[model samples]
Target: MKRNEGSFEFVVGLNRYWLKWFGLWPHCDRFSSHRLFVTLLMAISLLIPMTACLFESNDFADHIEILSKLIPIIMVTIKLFILRVKRNYLRLLVEEVARDWKNFGQLELYEKDVMMRYAKLGRLINIICIVFLFLVQLGRLDMRFEQSEEIGYSAYQALWYDLSPGTARFFIILILRSRKPFNITAGKFYIMSMSSFMNILKTSGAYLSVLKAIK
Candidate 1:
């Protein structure tokens, strides 16, 4: 953990409460109450919807058709498990974010405004997840990172050609980095993007329909 890991709290404060509750904060733990809460949460989510099955009439052939409730829990579990296994990497990512926030004053005015806009968008997405499920927020972050392409174009339009060679070189470097596109991934396997999310939604829906038809 970096010395300034705790510092983002001043800048971010209450916005991090949800992250800490989910155990997505950078700090590690030997015994996490958050994990216990998550386990209990998952268990409850898996069980509560099943109560609907209890009301089903015995006359129906698929009388125990609890698949509807089960599907969301299963998807959520897979997503959470992936996150749990990759917690170390996620911690590093979080630390880097805190470090960046620590250096926030170092950025140019326009740069800071651009970053704050993205941060607000990310915050909005996270709020939506709390109101629903966690999937949508991940997609929105991926989509927002793709906006680096705009940064590159904006840099090009900054009249860098009229500047001294040394300053122009810095703009060139910025453009080069922006061209690479920042992204988050699920380990090395999946590029977390809006298109990937769309595919996941399609697959989930198709599977749900198929399961319903089988009943």
Candidate 2:
């Protein structure tokens, strides 16, 4: 059923008034399509270490691994929430910028700035992932050297090596898509960015614990 615009506006104003009184107004909108994509990417990244837990038969180890995965998952979820909030903020920002949009050059300049920022971020993530992959491959080589006398690295080890880089790449894409801040970082408490290496580390640690248990 179609509702009257006047009624709809009245309801919105009422809600806004209440929300403001409750200190809940102006909440960010983090549920946009871009944010959803980022969340999925982060999830896939966390799944990398999960493959290690698969080889273990010990329930206790599996449980620990499960616990480890929780942190990154939660962090990613929070990031999604923040992204939603940021989207709401963007609406306000666009409104502010719109008045200045009368000049075609200014609008084009803003678009150019946005594209440049994203492009740079993309390059940075690609470089980081490349480095991460190289290190992982080196570790795999070392693992194989030790296992040469045996089966030449167990299936679990091989899978971990394979999956980790892919997971890292997924995170890179996630960061790219999420519009997460790259330059700015905080102490251990937070990355000061939507998605972060710290989050990946926390999640990877949990999965690693699980893998260690299996081993």
Candidate 3:
């Protein structure tokens, strides 16, 4: 396949499939405005729970719970920043991969195998993480439900009133927080792709190793 075709397939067709399924797609568009909006939304989502925990929750356990939630959000935020900075490099790398796969004769099979393995592994890891996060959210919700029943409160009341089931806020928090996991997954995939590409170049006796020497 041509470089553009291959790059397009790998990006829009493959990588984004799971992203969309997980509701973590970054909503790639021609304009930077949409990305900025999404980033703002994610920031607000993270801040809301954190603000609640700091000023509203009096219990130490509440602090722990909020901190736990913050961990993933922080991770995702860092990854998104990394991706935004490296966006051009990532695109060029994809095109390079396509060119090498198509033009390199002896290394074609090895290149294809390595790329496929890493891609599959990355996708698998993303799926597992997504599923695990979902389960954790579900468990938090179940606990919230039980607490709400005991306290004779509704879900919304539990959240609004800072009751035992206030963790129910996690639902809305996670919906807006989707950017974190999406960016994290995309970041991981990008890193793996770059690593695999470099390894292939080194193994194939390419001068690309010079780039590594500088780093």
Top candidate, metric lDDT: 1
- The regions of model 2 sitting more than 4 angstroms off are 1-60, 93-215
Off by over 4 Å in 1: 1-7, 10-16, 22-24, 37-65, 132-215
Q: lDDT tens digits, residues 58-113, model 1?
A: 54545445664466667766666677777789778777887787777777989778
lDDT of 3 by residue, 31-52 (tens): 4545545775777688777867
Candidate 3 segments whose C-alpha is farther than 4 A from its true place: 2-14, 17-27, 55-58, 101-111, 153-215
Task: Please give the distance, in angstroms, between residue 96's alpha carbon in candidate 1 and its true position after superposition.
Answer: 0.9
lDDT of each: 0.70, 0.51, 0.58
* Model 1 C-alpha lDDT versus the unseen true structure: 0.70
User: Which is the winner by lDDT between candidate 2 and candidate 3?
Assistant: 3
Model 2 residue 209 CA deviation in Å: 42
lDDT of 2 by residue, 98-134 (tens): 3333332434666746644654565566667767865
Question: How high a TM-score does candidate 2 get?
Answer: 0.25
Error of 1 at 146 (Å): 46
